[model samples]
Target: MRNDIQIDKRSIGINFIDGKASVRIWSPDSKSLEVKLENKSIPLTKDDFGFWTITTTNIQPGDLYKLVINNEQEFPDPASVSQPEGVHGRSAAVDVSSFNWTDQSWNNLPLADYILYELHTGTFTPEGTFEAMVSKLDYLKELGVNAIEIMPVAQFPGSRNWGYDGVFPFAVQDSYGGPEGLKKLVDACHAKGIAVVLDVVYNHMGPEGNYLGAFGPYFTSKYNTPWGNAINFDDAHCDGVRSYFIENVLMWFRDFHIDALRMDAVHAIKDFSPVHILREIKLHVNELSQHTGRQHHLIVELDLNDTRFINPLEEQGFGMDGQWIDEFHHALRVTATGESTGYYSDFSGIADLAKSYKDAYVFDGQYSHHRQKFFGIKAEKNPGQQFVVFSQNHDQVGNRMLGERTSELVSYEMQKLLAGAVLASPYLPMLFMGEEYSEPNRFMYFVSHTDKELAEAVRKGRKEEFAAFHAEGEAPDPVSEETFNNSKLQWNLVKEGQHKTMFNFYQQLIQLRKEQPALKHLNRQHLKVSFDEAAKTLLLHRWHEDQHVVCLMNFSQQEQKIQAPTEASNWRKLLASHEPQWLGKTEAPETFEAGEEILLQPESIVIYQNS
Candidate 1:
């Protein structure tokens, strides 16, 4: 029987075609390139389009190979689909078609319905593998989250990393079960009706094992970021470079079957071309969504407070579905914990929190004291759902001087009140892993760089980065084994003592957000906040059609009696943070009359509904 399997020659990596393997690579600066498979060398022909290609039958799936450029250096494939060996070793051919996918009917969840759970795979479980994560799918399903945003899983330099240092954008980390393990994990998530959103770093690649610079001008010195050199998106010979990263976005959605991508730190991606790189990606993803009959979303992480990132392209915007709003976290944190340092210096108390809750962006073209400039554009027309708000995330918690999470910074009652405020807001809410149950472990910055020189450099850099905060002791070594081990989540604590109550409270709040039309409708126009700065109290009112939800919170440290909102007539108490059933000592009346005064304990929130 003659095999008629055909693969696109323009594909970036090793592709199987009719019992033969066709390898294509982008190496514009190299004089020549060759593929070494099974001790046999095959020369590749370079095309005018800057791609070098060779077709050979000797290269099969699972065969180890390396790229020999200009007869001098041998490096792993830049777009290797699976780096079975370490980053410094050779790459292996992966047959993506071999994995069995059972999620034929799985579609991406709507933006309005995304209750995001952000997790770092290396620390989320003790085993720290994709297979281990599958065992906890039932727990996540019971927790009532519809989406999971995985931290970056690309191949880094060593056995462990926070994943931001990933060098090879296409290869899954070998230690984290590689491509096959990830497929099984994504499949398991879909089987449990959970959508997978992958976090990808496009601003910069890791320092070590980055060979793209050896082959071409992949970085530009025109702009600088915290990460060394910026990617060459608009510089000379950048068409090929732009295509390289854009294809990466499609690879995750097409080959890995990811429902969405969360682009990390897009503000660092500087491009001045006629069409921005972000705009190009948004246009291509829009096409992919229409062609595949599957929903694909792009959520960008930017602190510039620019609305163009989430606006529709028809209105001269980038056309992303959502953007992570760090200001929301800052406003909530400053109000809840009163930590006014660094970026937290800009936000005030309950008034700022109320502003973020109602307008989506608190710094809407306002002068920022921290930045010392007018920082953000207005987002008046944008719906609240376009902004993903979170009380605690990796950066806010992990980047701290001691890597302490919110549970350690605030009182237990304050944690519960903050949870209620986040869940009841009109914006989409995200829960950092272990945050739902107030896990005690610190999500510290950890890595395992194999190169001693590079490891020492990372340690020095970490210390210098935290110098402004005046950390008490020396910063923890990023490459230390102890740091990595200590960051793992203590999953057993989720069912013990007060932790169990917090977990159950999270579940109930998630269910209420899903069932309540007012919560899920995500209309900022209908979401109202009335805050009294003197009393340190806030009243949030949300309504859709005839259904309404009223949440009243007290941030002060003493018991206080506050007047109900004018629209609080015929309201029934749904949830109170001080109830004894939730490990508290106080409870409110089940029903209340209009204009009645309600007593609230310190750092507590009460939610009411009118049926």
Candidate 2:
């Protein structure tokens, strides 16, 4: 009954106590349940809480076992913390308390001060292991990134996956060095003064190795998700289902020492309970944070522009810290590349980008051509840190026909322009892995499913999806090992010519964002954005206290001439992408005169501080 691991306080998973192991399984629908371990079968007793339990002195850590339902149907533990072999293998007992952690003095940074760098464990490095990433902590720190949002590490079908296909939510991927490897990475990151954000999927389970239905009604038939049946959060016997995922959230924060959880596609999580599941998670996370005396945050990936998610709980909302704003990326991409195929059709260029700067949502209450309906609610009341902005992310790149990154879609100057726009905004900025140096490799969607039929179907689905973009030629095989190899980041490019320059440009921009008074504080109320449609110029003016900063951006391929933003012009140039040091083709004066016509180089950005 003692809370050894704060998450294990529920007493659902197998726990070791006083030289004995206690096993518990929640199978409300099962008439009988027993443990099948080694060569023996141990029967379990059912309780009023609908969980079958047993205690045996013979069990030990590292032992693999499965639950036998009604003495016939056998499946891995639903609350397994270690799936050693794979998702289909038996669950192994893991003693998380055995690891000695030295992060006692470490705590997470405030959400407003975060500069996030998102990376996939498999593709971020060649070794593709959590332990392998320890070597790059200093590199990220040097790049001015204080937090890293890692893609999912749950136990999936095979060694190669996007992690959304994970079946065991509690277990870390065996190919990624498992739980111990993850702990070491977190500990090292904390030592380097970097926070860790983990991506989690609760919408639906993967097709293969998913056996939750055999135990109980973990899913509901009333509503559906993009994957299939939705989680049973509001249906019959939903308390157990809610507890299952809430405990998972606590497990990551308490056991792994993760600072935040990036919930994947929260719009897909169909829940209609009296109190939403997200609110429950927020309540529990707040409790855990209070108990541990560490700051923890919940960030959601929501398609809708609803501000209710980030609104405080007392205001009858979910109270999430932030959500990813895809509209900003869409507008910036359309402006940079002139690509308006699928969803990009909804956004108009610099205007939306400017709107996203002042207001968090560009499509707020506007009719979306792609959806053929009025979408989004205005979120201007929310603070800047309530939204996260990026020019390139996993969905923006991998969902493409060729998986081409933003760097591949536009010229070098345009890439710099996009980075400047994202960093200058009132919201928090994020950079996809390999984006700082503009790595040439692609981030295609690749998978390795054990089921041959399912694998083939995935390839077909990918091809059909590409039809929306009207891409020519066949897509590279997603199931091919070669595809996974092609997606890995080219780390060597960092030391190369133009790539190295791009890295410095990003580093300077981030450093200015943190050090400058106007840019450091994420205050939406003290910013103004306006765009000239004819000249393809956007002006962003931000101020905090008395420090004023002006960003002049030219999005056109041709050079633009714009009037000065202020009549009194004694501005200090903080950064100019057209400078020779930034590998630019043109140069401009360091200070601007009053009523002067400033010439902006094609596809370049210039930041000036009012002197």
The per-prediction CA RMSD against the true structure, in angstroms, equals 3.0, 1.9
Q: Tell me the tens digit of each residue's lDDT in model 2 across 235-328.
A: 9988888888888888889889999999999988888877889998998888888888998999999998888888999999999999999999
Q: Candidate 2 regions off by >4 Å?
A: 1-10
Measured by TM-score, how close is model 2 to the native structure?
Answer: 0.98
Query: Model 1 TM-score?
Result: 0.97
**Cα displacement (Å) at residue 524, model 2:** 0.4
Clashing pairs in 1: none
lDDT of each: 0.86, 0.89
> Model 1 off-target regions past 4 Å?
1-10
